[model samples]
Target chain A: NAGVTQTPKFRVLKTGQSMTLLCAQDMNHEYMYWYRQDPGMGLRLIHYSVGEGTTAKGEVPDGYNVSRLKKQNFLLGLESAAPSQTSVYFCASRTPRTSGKNTGELFFGEGSRLTVL
Target chain B: EDQVTQSPEALRLQEGESSSLNCSYTVSGLRGLFWYRQDPGKGPEFLFTLYSAGEEKEKERLKATLTKKESFLHITAPKPEDSATYLCAVITSSTLGRLYFGRGTQLTVWP
Candidate 1:
């Protein structure tokens, strides 16, 4: 089964342009997250959703917006791309704690490489 | 403040040479600690999870051990294919669904 899949594997945007990265997971996980990875820096959370219709800010949510319209999909939108936002983006999904298992592990997508000029 | 730190920033080892990576964390309460291996141009792949102190897990050439304040990932007789960035992340009591990640340790194994 394709656990987690991200769309637009690679993209290039000029400054001030807008784009969206789509993440879809078939694991039926209840929680989904968006993160960005840069050189010498760990993956930083951008936004997360505990479930459908619920979204929350994460450690690095600025300049990014997220939506979880469905249980299996999480979308990350950059309203206005900037050079600083040119980083590899990752999406992950996790099962809820109530799954009666040690469900702290996350299944990640391959990642979407975005470059802003 | 709650945070996770990993060191030494990078490491280079000869084939069959063994070494360990360190991940130290200070948070309000520790729920679980996780290890992930990331290769170039790819996503981080899950390795092991330690829930409490004095716990250890092993797979292939890697062994992960955890204590109250830190976790260690030991590579035994590494091969060139084992080269990758190892990441450490933690789930705190205050942030059940969120994981705080360390900068990660880049490991290079040369044949």
Candidate 2:
């Protein structure tokens, strides 16, 4: 099974350009998240969705917006990209914990490397 | 403020050498600690989870243990294929799904 899959494994964009990264998961998890990883910095959450039609801001949400149009897919969009936005993006999904919140055991996609020039 | 710190930013070991990676955190209402391994160009992969102090879990060449303020990921008899960046994260609050992560310990095992 494709646990979690992300599209556009690699991309290069000019400054001010716009793009979208797609994430799909077959685990039927209730929670999905978007994160970016940089050197010396662990994965930081960009945005997340608790379920379909619901999205919330995360630690680094300024340059990105997310939508969960379907239960199995989460889309991350950069309306206007910047050079600082270049980073490796990852998508993760997990079943809820006993308290109904995601408790750290997450399955992740390979990652999408975006280079903004 | 919640913080997670992992020590030995990087490590290099020979095949069969054993070592451990450390993850320390400070947060209120600790819920769980998680360990993940990420290969170059890949996303982090789940390794283990520790809910409370003294808890331990084992996989083939890895073992994870937790305490009130820190967690350890012990790698026993490593191989080149086992080299990867190891990440540590903590689920601090029950109301939020956010997992605070550390910088991670990058390991390289030379065969």
Best by lDDT: 1
Classify candidate 1 by CAPRI docking class.
medium
User: TM-scores across all candidates?
Assistant: 0.97, 0.95
Could you tell me the TM-score of chain A in candidate 1? Answer: 0.95
Tens-place lDDT per residue, model 1, B32-101, is 8999999999989999989899999999999999999999999999999999999999988898879879
Write down the lDDT that model 1 would get.
0.93
The residue-by-residue lDDT of candidate 2 on B14-110, one tens digit each, is: 9999999999988888888999999998889889888889999999999999988899999999999999999998887753677768999999999
lDDT on C-alpha atoms for all candidate structures? 0.93, 0.91
Model 1 agreement with the true structure over A86-112: per-residue lDDT tens digits: 999999998857445445588899999
Q: What tens-digit string does per-residue lDDT give for candidate 2 at A24-79? A: 99989989999999998889989999999999988899989999999999999999
DockQ metric for all predictions? 0.72, 0.70
Off by over 4 Å in 1: A98-102
